[model samples]
Target: MYVLDTNIISELIRPRPNGGVVQWVDTQPLSSLYTTAVTKAEIYYGLHILPMGKQRGDLEQALHQFFSAGLQNRILEFNSTSAMEFAMIASYRRKAGIPISNADAQIAAICSQHGFQLVTRNVSDFAECGIEVMNPFTE
Candidate 1:
């Protein structure tokens, strides 16, 4: 299974998205892909912060398409297991001075807890978190 990061979701909605990401996603079954609650919240926060304009409109439209176009069922929530995983990862990172943000930790926790390979453009941020990560933007 694959868990999509926020940036990857943004790429999918772009008019000219990253070709590597597009191709990789196209070849995979939709059921194998998922978006975590962390990612969803980030996307929504981004859209909401944009000024009222065409850019915002476009982003909003793309976001709607993302949810409505058969990707809705894959949104993973922050359940008890996810929370426990988050606590563990967050505590470890803090003790190790890794300085990982809460959102990224939550996303990584969900992915790790579920044994999902994370798909993201920000590959380095998730390194050493004990989960497989694939950078679709890479060659």
Candidate 2:
């Protein structure tokens, strides 16, 4: 299984004219698509920057589409298991002297804990976390 990063989801949610790569990626089998609860938060927070009009409605509609898609998508909820995983990830980061956003760190930890490959546009940002990374853009 693979977890889709927020930026990739955003692109898929509202494909750009030049987003041929995103469009192509979206056509792939849904069996491989997944996203974390953090990604859900990212998408929701992103919508706040837009006007409270059609754009907000559009974003909500996109979210509905994601929920209806035939993927076994699950929110990577935080629990004792995830907390342990997060602590371990943070320890590693601390030892390595790496700085990462809390949300990014949580995403990396979830992927690592669940043995899921991370599909993202920002490979370099996650490289230090040592999780498997797939850039659909290059595929």
Candidate 3:
């Protein structure tokens, strides 16, 4: 299984998404693809911060449709198990003097809890999290 990071998800909504990412996604089975609630929130927050206009409206519509149609029940939630995993990951990173954002930690927790590899453009951000990561933009 694979959990799509926010950047991977965001690329899909781009006017001209990266060809490498698109091709990589296309080669995977839809059943193997998953996303976290954190990713959903990130996408929504991004759209929310944009000024209201035709561009925003169009992007919103696209995003809504993408979530409603493509993702459906594949969105993972960060529950108790994930929370515990988050605590461990955060503590370890902190002690080692490696900084990770809360959002990235949460996503890493979900991936760790579920034994899923992460698909992201920012592979290095997740390197120390001890979860498998694949950079679709590169491979």
Candidate 4:
């Protein structure tokens, strides 16, 4: 299984997303992709900050569809296993002088706990966290 990061979902909802990512996603079986609840909240958080307008309305609808697709497939939730992974990853980053936000840590934790490869554009950010990451936006 694969974990769809927040940036990946954001790219998909944008007016013009990375063609490589779009193509890569299209070629993959929908069942192979998954997103954490954190990603969904991130999308909604972005939409919430947008000024009221047609653009926001459109984005809201797009987010609804994006979430619906994942819901049908699976939306991984944070659990005990996730916490164990998070503690290890967060502590390691701290000891290594690497700074990662709580949200990013949560995403990484879920991926580690489930052994899901994370698909994202920010490849370097998730590196060294003991989670597999893929950047489909690359050539």
Off by over 4 Å in 1: none
lDDT of 1 at 47: 90
Range of the 10 consecutive residues with the lowest summed lDDT in candidate 2? 15-24
Model 4: residues with Cα > 4 Å off, grouped in runs = 70-73
lDDT of 4: 0.88
Supply the TM-score for candidate 1.
0.94
Candidate 3 residue 54 Cα shift, in angstroms, is 0.5
Ranking by lDDT: 3, 1, 4, 2
- Please provide, for model 2 over 1-139, each residue's C-alpha lDDT reduced to its tens digit, 9 standing for 90 to 100: 7888887777676646236556656676677677888888888888777788986887788777775563344666656786777787777887888767888888988898898899888997787786899877776
TM-score of each: 0.94, 0.84, 0.98, 0.95
Model 1: which residue pairs collide? none
Best by TM-score: 3
Score each candidate by Cα lDDT: 0.89, 0.77, 0.94, 0.88
- Residues 1-139, model 3: lDDT tens digits: 9999999989998999999999999999998999999999999999999999999999999999888888889999999999999999999999999988999999999999999999999998997898999998877
- Clash count for candidate 3 is 0
Worst 10 residues of 3 by lDDT: 63-72
Enumerate clash totals for all models, in the order shown.
Answer: 0, 0, 0, 0
Ordering by TM-score: 3, 4, 1, 2
What shift in Å separates residue 66 of candidate 2 from its native position after superposition? 1.7
